[model samples]
Target: MTGHLHPLHEALERLDEAWGDADDAGQLSRRQLIAVTEALGLLHRRSGAMLAEVAACVAHESRTELGAASLAKEQGFRNAAQLIATTTGATAGDASRLVKVGEATAPRRNLLGEATPPKYPAAQQALAAGRLSAPAVAAIIALLDRVRLTLGATETAEAERLLVERAQGLSLDDVRRLVTRAEAWLDPDGVAPREQEQRDRTSLSIFERDGRIHLDGDFDAARGAPIVAAVNGYVSALFAAQKEQIDPEAPDAARRSVAALRAEALSVLCAHALGCEDEAPALAGASVVVRIDVSDLADGTGYATIDGSDLPISVSTARRLAAGGGVIPCVLGTDREILDYGRERRFFTRAQRLALAERDGGCAMCGLPPSMTRAHHIRWWKRDAGPTDLENGVLLCESCHHRIHDNDWEIRIEGTGRQSRVWFIPPPHVDPDRTPRLGGRARYDVVA
Candidate 1:
């Protein structure tokens, strides 16, 4: 119809040419496989850009102004998104996102028929260049559109440019992070009000489902940060312990899924909270850790980040958490050292548990957090006349503790203090050679 084929048709042709046959993928070299993946991804993005524009046009034609003769009404669909979804076999949500992005980036004409730039020119350019996905563009546009009213025109344009630039070559999740921070920067005055909105919406529901109790809940950033941190920390600890399981098929192996572990962690946390209600209760450990820049803390501006979350929270919320002892105000750094009491105490002190947390990063045998673990002797206090020294004590969760005792697995400490590492020696049945496997923090290292 034109000098060049439609972009969608060209993209489809290129995809077909580059992809060849799907069955041949298995025979291709790793390098060729990666190149093919990149090529396909680019073609998909090109088609996505064209699809968004087409969907937006369809939406415009189907606008309610057309009454009963609307395009969608004639096409036997309720609305444009439904029509697009039905035609493309995509989810309604995905189709709606495409329309939103297309409308935000499409060239505009005033009532007088004067041409004007799109709402987000940078995002439009990125989408047209196939450098951003529909979802990414929608996310960036949503954030900018939400905060633009509160920001100056220049600030709004600058934020749009920066977000579009940062979002390229990044995953959708990464784009969300950039958006989160940008929102705080672009509309600092709105953070407290939005936080209040979230707080107003916080709710929890519990009911019996089938044979088990089910919990459904929602929390705002300020109120939910600590709970999120604790639950995730406990889950990580359980995961670390499970990683060291010598026999997953064993009768009592730690083989719970992440969902199950999170449930267990929640139960343990509730129980611990109840225990703290009694007089002479045990000392409570920090459940949440909030991090903020010194300058922000002083100026009462910007945002703070809570552990286990990518969302940015208002400085006021961070200050509130800090006042409540939920945030670790100061870094311990290297000034803290492992405390040793050679058989002088039966239980590990809080100071000592903190030190062990630094070294083991949780349970020595598994990766459970220090709060849920006991400081057991590498050499038993009673059986082997083990000392209560830091070097001799090891952190073990209940499951791993019983596992070592029942299965004859051994824990060894190599080096001293923070430089030390934990190793688990498997029994003969598990490993005939009884080889020592690396445990503790090193187990969580990203191996290249």
Candidate 2:
């Protein structure tokens, strides 16, 4: 470093120094803790900028000078991505991305020895400034690269500039939203064609590897967005459920890793999809039997193992995963006596789903389209041991389902078939008197 350190670099250095001195920060109030989190996030971004800078150099030397493709082959690696992945311990997807980003953001030169501008100047600047992470850069590139020809160079550049600015303090998801909107704006006629093209590109694959299911796929926005919403909602619900089940006095047990939760959610989703088959195997039959040593189950303090895996989830998460569904909780006494065996009839049948969809008119709380809603047992089949029946079943969008669980809202079915209505009972905090709100088309008499 010959010149003075970049402003972001200097700030990061100072942040590290200050952070080291704040050893007792774990005890900060929630608000202060949030700030500390934000501070670390910014520092991480600063580090990302340096990472981009180094990646650019690596990309130039390895790919341009030594011919990355051939050199990597000579090194006995499958490709550049494998070389990077082996070195960094990143997934192939991540390693491949950095390699691409480095190549895209690297300097260029014409055959006549004239300087050629980088393809993504805004992204390059943002990366150098530590304003964008490698993943964000990849997202911007991926989105822009999709419809760039249709959008034209001017529109694409403008989108890149605006997106870089928007990505500064926003998440990669937010950045994607920004790019998506911009792409839509830049090409009005191209939107449908792009979506169609993307749909044509959709795919999904699931394979078992060492008792764990590995999922990989690409989906266009129309299909992809819902999956994102579902996974996010379920993941959020998992964490919220864990918090609720905590004793509020003891050490908070570690919840399942995000990866594990995502896998579990996908499993639940697969169960729903597969149930549509008339001869579909009973998903509940292959119940995830959780064996807990009774003391832990009651104390809500210890762990239980799901069958076929040694990874122990807290009793809290165990209960949540077992709710109205595929998991069977088996509690044993100190002498290993069978204390409790959770019932098997839980997950809603495909017939039940179709029946509820017709009855509920979409989410019981919000009127999202039926396709976006999940089958939620109003009486909570797990906790209440409610049966998977029409009177107890309703379609609830992912968000509303989570809200009902996390926000402590109540749901009930009032009236008989053909006149039955689903109602939500707001929490007392939401409505001091706990008003009963019903779902239906509101009619107002107007004299014409």
Candidate 3:
């Protein structure tokens, strides 16, 4: 058996030598040669295994002093096993295997004996010095082990040399974590890079409809506060006024119904303006007309005539008086005391219209530009409840006013004092969130 194995081992050694020359000359393409070389390498490992078995036999004899002449003392196998295990942190069984292989191959004219093996001494030292962690050291060791199993002896030795050079500054633990994350990327099910990029880049419409208003938009948490404040302001104002009119035992639905509250509030304003309590009086003998002409009615001299007399009041007061009621009653008095003469005429006046323009601005339903909006009464003057007062009137854009009166929607002024407000209730399908969804803030800029 010894004679036959000698020739085969010599042939294998010659083959390994030729493969080395080809690799060094850059004549062997890695892909083309790897398969052939791996097969030969496996055969070489078997030869090493045979030698390891012989060494194991000899070492066992040396350990049994009373048996066959001991070989462990001659080979120093015990010390070699201890040293390999301590330096490599290999299992006792693995350390024994390596020691046996080393002993068997040491006597043979093989490079394994002299190959300055990478025990990862530098990595181990780095871990001890706190520069590298245990995991990183373990990664390096694992890579080295794989190289040894798959490559030629010379190739494995070269890989170890390169690895030790690169592992200089890195900690074992950091290297391990890095490699692990890298491995995750290899998974086919991992999140695509483009999808992640889109997530990082991930705005908030405020419009009106069938008696209902809608607020639908997207905004990040940081920018969302303003919208919430605006919505809450309207809702709170509406609720506060509703609570004042309705009894506490009122059905929650009725009390909270924005439509019901708006109607009641408009009724109150109309009543107050007509000099009547609760409801507006009928205009049985009153004349009704609506017109707009830019003129100074307060100065008592303007382009238009009142009661067939050219009497003008200040522009501000004229506007107020006109909006108050078309016909001004002659009163003999100073600013403090007045002696009323008589009710001369009753008509919608320029002053009242101008007041409506100034107070409501444009569409009460929508904050359209004043030029495009028109005045609308909460209660129709024909119904005998509508008054030409600022509170009884709401400015709405042409489109919105058309939709309100034509579509049967309601509008009103709500709240009192600081919370006094104006709102339009849209029909359903405009806002499913709230019935008669409240109108947004009036667009007119409040002059401070």
Candidate 4:
């Protein structure tokens, strides 16, 4: 209530007031509720900025022996992140982000405890004004830190102002573009060198644990931009399919989460990368090697041992992988004898791929563009003696392709000539009657 009160204390009081104001959220009209929610967000952001400033001060004090270090250490915490996580009920990742944002944007003080300015003045001002989100502020601080190395303090300050102005009118992506553009315009020569430094830091790792493939990687901006574009392209297809399956107007009503879509997008990227002729020579022949016993192949009820992995893959997966995703079928005789190694013979050829593009129009399952789809065999090549020809192949998008492999779905090719169709049958769990649904749209348009 006093003019001399600390900003953090004042912010807390304002936040409490804001909460009290919103006490009748359920009773409010829909129009009033929307307005109140937007207003509350600004209040939340203001309070959050104050909290971040406080966190920074605590972190600074903890660095010195006079702060939380001794107490945190006593509680068996080794690092600031762990300490923050233990004290607050936040996850380690969230705690780390908070600590980073605090360090980058928070105000500072000297030994005598006199008020000192923050390192990122523009960002700090923007945060206090509720014009910049926490993520935007953090992004600016990180970019400015690097830009500061190349430009003088004055130039960096100017860049910050430009970025702040852009942040107010533009999206977070636009802010990123502005930062990237500023870096290029200010220090064109430094771009390549900086990219080289980041590239040297780049690493990709793929490992399987707990029956799932885990991918972790670091990519520089030059390499990363295209990858992001590719993944988003596939993500568009996934969301499109989701819209068809669910409600287009209400994306929140879609069955799959954004994370699930992203994972599928990565899968699409991998498939697209492999399909490219210009890929690395090692991956040029990247056939999923599945070793299936002759008996398993005959009875259609056993695991197919993938090469380089002792753990067996489901029979459905072996069939799908053999038909789709490109596979090297290694059939095994009794007593683990090698019967056959279907090399490029079983894999779909470039000619077949072209034929599929023409026939399927796009994904046979969801009607995504041909580029977003893969030519999967309708009849199992290994089990059903299905040939690697256009007759047996059906183009399915990545998500649908995964569905056929992972779930209890079945796909088959029916009819002849123009009437030829791909029929998708759901698992018995979904429909006991097991009615088949046709993939893609009608070959000829039917006027409503």
Compared with the true structure, all predictions reach lDDT values of 0.73, 0.60, 0.42, 0.59
Provide TM-scores for the models.
Answer: 0.68, 0.45, 0.22, 0.45
Q: Quick one: RMSD of model 2?
A: 18.2
The CA-based lDDT of model 1 is what?
Answer: 0.73
lDDT of 4 by residue, 1-448 (tens): 5642354455565545544545566766554564556566666666567656666655655564654445446556766667777777777765666667777776678899997887777788888776776666766677777768778989888877777766663446545544554555555445445545776898899999999889898875434533543554555555554556643554442477757766766775677667876543121112234555677678765455342221234455566667754455656553322112233368787556544544454577655655455677776788877777766787777688888878778877675433356678988865577898756423311100
Off by over 4 Å in 2: 1-9, 24-35, 64-76, 112-116, 198-448
lDDT of 1 by residue, 1-448 (tens): 4523365566666666666666678876554565577777777777788888889999999999998888999999999999999999999999998999889989999999999999889998898878998888998888888988888789889878877876777667656756776677677677777778888999999999789998999998767777766776666555444466633653331556767777877887788787976552122343565656677778887666554354567788888788886555423333345688778787777667666765665566656555566677888788888888888877777789999989999888888766677889998876678889777644532110
Error of 1 at 389 (Å): 25
Query: What's the CA error at residue 126 for candidate 1, in Å?
Result: 0.9
**Per-candidate RMSD, Å:** 10.8, 18.2, 37.4, 19.8
Order the numbered candidates by lDDT, best leading: 1, 2, 4, 3
What is the number of backbone collisions in each predicted candidate, taken in the order shown?
Answer: 4, 0, 29, 0
Off by over 4 Å in 4: 4-24, 65-81, 91-117, 169-182, 198-448
Model 4 residue 68 distance off true place after TM-score fit, in angstroms: 9.3
Error of 1 at 124 (Å): 1.3
Q: What local lDDT does model 4 show for residue 35? A: 51
Task: Specify the poorest-scoring 10-residue window by lDDT in model 1.
Answer: 278-287
What tens-digit string does per-residue lDDT give for candidate 2 at 1-448? 4342565666566555545545588756554565566667766666665555555555444563465455556676766667677777888888768866776776788999988888898898887666788888988888788778977999788877767766665567545545555554444445445556766889999899999777799975434544554554555555544567633552322455767766777777667777865453212122234555577667765454443221234456556655745445666553322111123557766555544544454565655534446677777776888767777777776678888989999877775443466778888766678878765211000000
How many Å off is the CA of 175 in candidate 3? 52
Q: Which ten residues in a row have the lowest lDDT in candidate 4?
A: 439-448
